[model samples]
Target: MDLIDRVNEISKRIKTLGTTLQTEEATKNALIMPFIQALGYDVFNPIEVIPEFTTDHGVKKGEKVDYAVTKDNEIIMLFECKKFGAELSPGHASQLYRYFSVSEARFGVLTNGATYMFFTDLDKPNQMDAKPFFTLDMQKFEKQEIDELKKFTKPSFNLDEILNTASDLKYTNEVKKILNAEVENPSDDLVRFFTAKIYSGRLTQPVLEQFRLIVKRAHKQFITDKINERLETALAHPELSVKDNASPSVLLNEVSVELDNGVVTTEEEIEAYNIVKAILRTKAGASRIVMRDTKSYCGVLLDDNNRKPLCRFHFNAKQKYLGLMTDKVETRVPIESIDDIFEHADKLVETLNEYG
Candidate 1:
């Protein structure tokens, strides 16, 4: 299987057997070992993966790390594991940090069998960084994260290549955290920065508070507008839509239906599709919301499933109509213009919830 499939399988295992694990050893046996194996390492081979790997740190004797991964008889990476569900903090990586300075390994990993933190000597030579350059939470991860994780696999492991991007990844992760905090609750400095550019009046406590609320609202609306703009662009260019990955048979069926019914997808119908997609983007991803044009109406489906219809646009006549599927029934709501589709945004989301 591929890296994504293997990672997803491990995720399923964690959800199924996580509660039963109560100790670090059980966690290693059930979760961490599988993760190591998934990286194309031979866990059973002591030459490649040595358990209870020992080294001396300064005056300390026989300091043992959980596992030491070796390549060509040289220690390349060290792992320090904790019990499942245990909160991983910098304190937990103390052993890995010390081992990194003495050993030839350039990378250190601290994991609780669920969240894996990857550390390297980026800040100082032969010294592990206080914060990890990259982190992976198995419970929730994206494809891009999986791709990054692949770089550490046995066949693809490259010391120089990883170090090249480590600095940028570390800084980017920190910046995203700061941006998320500022977006939700703008800091005084952030508020002042915006206020100075937009307002010439002197800053006061009341004005600061007023601008705080304004900044928060403006930030939220700006994000919404950007999402809507992208959705509209994707609708205008159907080739850009991720939903075009449908199977050949499904594509053939749609084409045949359109041909038989003499379907002509108009600009108004496409606009209605865009509006409906933007409303349900939070509930269901934009890619899962599909537009299937037919002679009678333009159908918006969930995962391209006809039975799970989200809504439809009937713009072939003088009076436009929106067909909302609720309670397994199509309810035609009459409207004067395509913009009226926004009136039933809640109903569209509710329809999607019914499928769940």
Candidate 2:
């Protein structure tokens, strides 16, 4: 199986057995060990994967990390494990951090069976960064996250190649976190910046409060407008709708219906497809969900069957709509952004269950 399948397998185990795992050792045997094996490492091989690997820090003896992964007779990665369902924090990585400085490992992982946090010496050489360069949650992950995890596999492990992208991934993750927070609740500085640009009056408590709400609404509308612009562009140029090396099962079909007619599949539509797939992933495999674009809307089907219509993206117009089927009747619900599809997750799942 590929990385996605392997990762999904682990996800299934977590969902099914997570509650039963009561101890740290049980968590390791049930979830963490299989994850190591998924990365093409032999957990039983002491040479490749050392259990309870010990490293000594200055004036500290026998400081042990959960596991140490070696390649070519050299330590390549370190791991620290916590019990199932435990909330992982930077404090949990102390032993891993100490091991990183002493060992030749370039990567350190802290996991609680479900969430894996990958740390590297991006901030300083031989010292693990306080923040993780990449984080993977077994229960919740995207295709791009699986792609990133694939690079760490035994076959594809390249120190320089991963380091090249680690900096960008680390900073990008941080920036996105900050941006998400700002979008949800505009910071004082962010509100003031927008206020200066648009408001002519003096900055007062009342004005600041007023601008805070305005900034929030403006951000939402701005995002919606940008999505509409992309949809318009894709509709104008149907040829550009086809992505290079696109996954047929995940995103676009091998020969999309768009090619038969003038219908164009926008990137936003592809994003919506992925979102729907993620929502119904546990109920239905991603391969079962297929994108079949039409001139009016982009239809997502189960098992490539029109009778099994899951949802549709009606993005050809100014106001986007998510076409959901219930009792064989289509409901075109108006949505501002692709993220809004998550709101009707139960309805989407219900539609899929009807077919089953």
Note the Cα lDDT for every prediction shown. Answer: 0.85, 0.85
Say which candidate scores most in TM-score: 1
Clashes of 1: 0
lDDT per residue for candidate 1 within 77-112, as digits (tens), equals: 899999998989878888998999988999999998
If scored against the real structure, what TM-score would every candidate get? 0.67, 0.66
Evaluate candidate 2 by giving its C-alpha RMSD to the native, one decimal.
Answer: 14.3
Displacement of residue 48 (Cα, Å) in model 2 is 1.1
Off by over 4 Å in 2: 228-356
- Cα RMSD of all models vs. native, in order, equals 15.8, 14.3
lDDT of 2 by residue, 52-158 (tens): 99877898898789999998889999999999999898788889988889899999999999999999998888888999999998987766678689788887788
In model 1, the runs with Cα more than 4 Å from the true position are 243-356
Question: How displaced is residue 318 in candidate 1, in Å?
Answer: 45
